[model samples]
Target: MNTPGTLYLIPTVLADDTAAQVLPPQVAERVAALSYFLVENARTARRFIKSVAPQQVIEELSLTVIDKDSTEAQIQAALHPVAAGQDAGVLSEAGCPGIADPGAELARRAHQLGLRVVPLVGPSSLLLALMASGMNGQSFAFHGYLPIERPRRVAALKQLEKQAISQHQTQLFIETPYRNQQLLDDLLATLQPGTRLCVAASLTAPTEYVRTDTIAGWRKQGAPQLHKQPAVFLIGA
Candidate 1:
């Protein structure tokens, strides 16, 4: 019999109508199949797990939860079982785990240990924004969370905007939920009025919204009322 050392990281369904992903029953089924899970947020992981099988009764899940904050030793110890045939399903607060998010470092550790890692289906705001940005998706880069410093962030945005417009290679990035407004503020300050701006907010959620317009139009809308919802910010020259 094969041991359960393998791990799986799945993606959530994108909120786009034309998105190529699904959720609910399938996600639940996949979670049910896992002998153990390494979640970025145990609360979210358990909540999602509960939502999937609200009626079913589980004696001991022992998914071996872990988050972005889990230490390296903790990650390695968690993977030991997966590498030995004990399956661990890694998940994020939402959407897919790993990618530009956490778990990649842990997944890499698993690989170095000769353990098999499996990723699952899920939503990704990055690709979703790219698809709708109307820009060249042939080549792109996710700069992750930009700098919080004013001068540095402005310089960074200016350089990226120039690169996107001149090279047409497409530049993708995101920011903290609360800091999104400030980031946009800085983006407008640095970039010109003619530049393109795309904001994809509350992706895959009830109040989900997407908009692609020029910096001037965006400014007229006055900063977006993100409050405390998830959103991705994209811009091109």
Candidate 2:
């Protein structure tokens, strides 16, 4: 029986045009050695590979898209090459794979198949924001995205705030880039006055911004224009 090849979990840059500064040299080296990749988007993955390993022939690489809509059969098929003893890499559209990304399912299946799974070091916007937030790093929760409707979102915010205060844990969450400003407004209005809030935007990029302030302070200072900019939000006591 042939031994299964390793499944590499590769992290992509958090922000555009910042791969050189954030991704370590070893990440590129590992990516350069892989010929098969499972990615959320083939176009962006190809672009990232080209930027990191310019000498790599994009045409020669095989990229399989494994997104939210991908099925169990599709995921198993994507790993066929690795199961047959050919190393493969999994790349997320942003940040680390399997962290609020579809790559989680792929990694789970890889483990069930007895394939070796390795994760390379790279920029993770969530971790970066948490590190700079001055909140509870020892214990925290990441809620991928809040509800779109105002009423439900507000209720969710209140619940998260209560959890943060009662358990002494940090509540981390994100919103669609375009809805960032609206989310901030809701946070300031729904959360208690003294509840600490952290808004980290465009992380690892030239226009990066990170600030931690109470809801009252944020209301007094005025909300930053966060429309269309990727951001992470955290709330804690």
Candidate 3:
């Protein structure tokens, strides 16, 4: 019987152009050795793999798509190659897999099946933003994406602020790129004047911007024009 192959949790660069600046050499080496991958987007995955391993034969690698809409059966089928002794990797569309990503399901299944799972280091926008935010990093929670409606979004912001204040923990979340400016407006409108808010926009990209300040400070300085940019938002006491 063939031995079960190891499952590699590969992290892709946060931005397409920042791979050279953010990716570690070991990550590329690990990616180069993989024969198959379960990725969020095959096109982006191919582009990313080629960027890291320029000499790699892209067409030779097997890829299966695993997004938020992927079913359990599809996830299991994707990992079948690994169970049959063919090494496989999980590549997220951006940053690390399994953190606010659908790849978590794949990793959980791999563990249940007793397959060896290895996570290689790479740029994680969440951690990077937390590190730069000057907030309480020791205690933090990532609440992925707030509500879309104004009333619900405002209530969510208040709840997040209360949690941050009461527990003295950092409340981190993200928004759809197109709604970034609206979210910023909502934050300034709903949050207390003295409440601290950190906006980390286009992280690891040429247009990267990470700033932490009170709501009042933000109003005075004017809002950052962060429309349609991948960003992380953090709030704390």
Candidate 4:
């Protein structure tokens, strides 16, 4: 007999209490209270937990960290207790817990066991950037991060761009913070001149920036100094 667990949705973004940003006060509070947390990246997740609760020493708590590389049976074994009656926090290295981050399967298991899932509100670079992209928001696709290889990545971008324009849909994606500049360079060199690009940087942070422009316009203004931080990108016809 285990205490039934609650699946809390935590986003890494910092924003107001909007539907788009549901990982702030609401989610963070529960995560801080939960006796156990199942995070994607233990090291990073520990750091974040500390940031949100300065007094809490996460390493001392009963937390389990899992990743895409983690074993399914191992993860399932941990959830056994939470699904019974304990509260568990599912988190990501950045952004939302289940978006682009691992934990989709764990969430399914929690649901099957009749656990209550609670989602918090906060920033989501994806929705925030797409809303400001001025692209066809009505029809859009989030293809996750593009390939790192030059040729394949460019070809993929071209194909997606073509499909978006032909179908009047906006193509959205993201990338590792450090490699963001490289991705931008590839887009600039490969995409057509008239294509529109939107970049949302440090969303909800003090130095947050949102810019939309054509490849030529961005090149002339020089690339933004994003450093190795999270950001979301959008491109359209």
The candidate scoring highest on lDDT is: 2
- Candidate 3 per-residue lDDT, tens place, 26-133, comes to 888988888799999999999999989888899898999999999999999998889999998899989999999999999999999999999988889999999999
Shift of residue 225 alpha carbon in model 3, Å: 0.2
Worst 10 residues of 4 by lDDT: 15-24
What tens-digit string does per-residue lDDT give for candidate 1 at 138-167?
Answer: 877788878888888998898889888888
Task: Report every candidate's CA lDDT.
Answer: 0.74, 0.95, 0.93, 0.76
The residue ranges of model 1 lying beyond 4 angstroms of the native Cα positions read 1-4, 12-21, 55-59
Q: Write the per-residue lDDT of candidate 2 for residues 1-237, one digit (tens) a residue.
A: 888899999999988898889989999999999999999999999999999989899999999999999999999999998999999999999999999999999999999999999999998889999999999999999999988999999999999999999999999999989999999999998989999999999999999999999999998999999999999999999
TM values, all candidates: 0.87, 0.99, 0.98, 0.86
TM-score of model 1 (CA atoms): 0.87
After superposition of all CA atoms, the RMSD between model 3 and the true structure is 0.9
What C-alpha RMSD separates each model from the true structure? Answer: 3.2, 0.7, 0.9, 3.4
Which predicted model would earn the best TM-score?
2
By TM-score, how accurate is candidate 2?
Answer: 0.99
**By lDDT, is 2 or 3 better?**
2
Q: How close to the true structure is residue 178 of candidate 2, measured as C-alpha lDDT?
A: 94
Q: Give lDDT for model 4.
A: 0.76
Sorted by lDDT, highest first, which candidate order results? 2, 3, 4, 1
